[model samples]
Target: MSAATVSSVPIPSRGWRNDMVAALFWLLTVVGVLMMTGAWFLLALASLEEGTEQPKALAAGTTMAGTTLWLGIVPLVFAHIAGFALCLVATTGRFDRARGVLWAGEAVIGASLIGLAVVLVLSGGQLLYTPPDYVP
Candidate 1:
C-alpha cells in the first residue's frame, strides 16, 4: 500500500497466495524427505553407547514400527512434493509470479534441510557419547 512498493514492483493477484502456500507446503515436504533420509541413515547404521538400547529392541514394539514409518515415508513424501511443485507450475498461469514464489519456497526448503543436518549431527554425536542410563 506504500508508494515505493506500489510503484517499484507488481504484486501477485488471482490465487497467488494460494499458489505460494502450496509451494511452501511442497518445500516443507522436501525438507521432510531430507530429515527422513537422515533418520533412516541413522537407523540403518544406528548404534549406541555400550549397552545402549537398540532401536529395534526397544521395550515398546512401536519404536521399530515408527522408525520404519519414517524411513518409508521419505520417498512417498518426495513424490508428493515433486507432484505439488509441478501442479503449481502447470496451473498457476503466470510464469514470472510463480517463479519468485518457487524460488522463495526452494530457499526455505534448503534452509530447513541445513537445519535438520545440523541438529542431526549435534544430537547424534551427543547421543553417541552419552548413555541414557548415566544420571548422577
Candidate 2:
C-alpha cells in the first residue's frame, strides 16, 4: 500500500476500551456491595442470637463474628469509594494496557484492607474476652 492510501485510512478510536474499563469497574462495585450486604446480614443474625442461652464457645464465636463484620463494614465502604475514584481516573487517562493493572491493584488493595480489618477485629475480640476463672 502507498503512503497516501495508509494515511487516508482512519485510526481506530479507544472509546470501546474506556467502556470496557468502566464496565469492569461497575462489576467490581456491584460485587463489593453484595459482600457488604452479606456481612450486614450475618451481623444481624449474630445480634438476634445474643439473648439465647448458648455455650461459652458458641457465645464467644458469635461475639467474634459480629465484631469482625462490624469492623469490616467501614473498610468495605471506603474501598468501594476509593475504587470508584481510581476507575474514573483510569478510564479518563491515556488508553493503554495500564488500565488493567490499575484495576488489579485497586482490587488487591480493597481485599487486603477488608482482610486486615477482620484479623484485627478477631484479635481484639479475643483480648476483650474474660476467662471463666477470672474474677472482677
Candidate 3:
C-alpha cells in the first residue's frame, strides 16, 4: 500500500471493553473516596467527648455514616482492591490504551488509603484523650 493510502486509513483505537472496564474502575474509585470521607467524618463524630451536646441532625448523620461504612464501604473497598489486582493480572502483556487512566486510579486509591489511615490515627488520639474517670 502507498504511504498516502496507509496514512489515510483510520487507526483502530482501544477496544470498547477496555474503555468500559476503565470507566467502571474510575466510578468505583470515586465512590470509594466519598465513602472514605464519610467514614472519616464518622470517626470524628465518634471521637467527640461523650458530654458534648450534638445537634440531632449531626447525630443522625453519624449513625448513618457508621452503618454505611461497615455495611457498604468496607466491602466495596475490599472488592475494588481485588478487582484492581485482577485487572493488573489480566492485562499483563496486553496493549492497553487506557493504561494511564488505570495508573491514575491506582494513585487515587493509594492516596485515599493513606488519608484514611491518618484519619484513623487522629480519631484514635482524640478518643484516648478523655480521662479515666470521664463519664457520659
Off by over 4 Å in 1: 1-66, 71-95, 124-136
TM-score rank, highest first?
A: 3, 2, 1
Q: lDDT per residue, candidate 2, 37-73, as tens digits?
A: 4444444344434323235547567433454345445
Off by over 4 Å in 2: 1-21, 36-95, 111-133
- Best model per lDDT: 3
Write one digit per residue (lDDT tens) for candidate 3, span 1-136: 7798768767555543466655665565565566555555454554353224334447667532244445445655665565465445444323564674476457456646754776667666452224356457
Steric clash pairs (candidate 3)? none
Best by TM-score: 3
What overall lDDT goes with each candidate model? Answer: 0.50, 0.51, 0.53
lDDT of 1 at 135: 54
- Against the correct fold, how does model 3 do in TM-score? 0.36
- Model 1 compared with the native: what TM-score? 0.30
